[model samples]
Target: MATAPLKRWVKPEIYPLFLAVGTAVGLCGFAMARNLAANPDVRINKEDRAAGVLENYDEGKRYHDHAVRRYVSDAKPEIMPGINKYFSSSK
Candidate 1:
């Protein structure tokens, strides 16, 4: 019987590379899920649309605006006054 060819040796670093990739993907998925749960109106799932469970365009827009306002206020409360002044001046 003919002997089988020797198996090629793979780099040991490849295992850690796979692990890092998996960790990144997992963290991304978790973050996405958390965001989706926080803002259900911004859903992009096909099933949600087909089942008529998703928000309408206007509702989604309003929700997005609200989220932006919240984020801006939380991250930089000083900016809110400037933003308000700018809008009032524009009007």
Candidate 2:
């Protein structure tokens, strides 16, 4: 009779310990599954775009240098006195 009453009390204590263990196992399984199911399609194409930009910059620098040389080669020296007389007379 005494043993039967003791068994009843022990059963209630066992239930909470089982519940705690079950909760921990469930949370761990969920995390593992989520990690395995992550995305795999993300990527960056920076190298190709950077190569094109560098090519364009080199071409632009060459073009600008040629234009500057041509302008300097064909430039005429101004007669400052004539320019000033023309503007002063016009006003």
Candidate 3:
């Protein structure tokens, strides 16, 4: 038995029309969302922020400062004591 040709669901020329319609719809939706968000009546505030909890920026900054001081500013000799000639003050 011979295999039958597959039926075409959408025409090639209609693809551009679909794309244009989809883009216009997406742009309309985006504009609507922006306007709605800017509206004071529906505008969200820090009380209703997107994230459940805000991170503590100061805590992170303090940790970074401490790490820098401990690891970089007060760095200790890593090599064995006998081979620490380069870091030795007497050298």
TM-score of each: 0.34, 0.32, 0.35
Would you list the C-alpha lDDT of every candidate in the order shown?
Answer: 0.67, 0.62, 0.63
- Which has the higher TM-score value, candidate number 2 or candidate number 3? 3
Cα lDDT of candidate 2 equals: 0.62
Using lDDT as the measure, the top candidate is 1
lDDT string, candidate 3, 1-91, tens digits:
2333223547687789999999999999976885566433343676656555545677455645664376766656565755675567573
- Which stretches in model 1 have alpha-carbon errors above 4 Å? 1-11, 40-91
Model 2, runs deviating above 4 Å = 1-10, 39-91
Weakest ten-residue segment in model 1 by summed lDDT: 1-10
Candidate 1 per-residue lDDT, tens place, 10-80, comes to 45767788899999999999778857775655456777657766446775656567755777665644647
Candidate 2, 1-91: lDDT as tens digits = 8899879777866998989999999989875664444312211356644554343556455544665587877656665867776888955
Model 3 residue pairs with clashes = none
Give per-model CA RMSD: 11.9, 29.4, 17.1
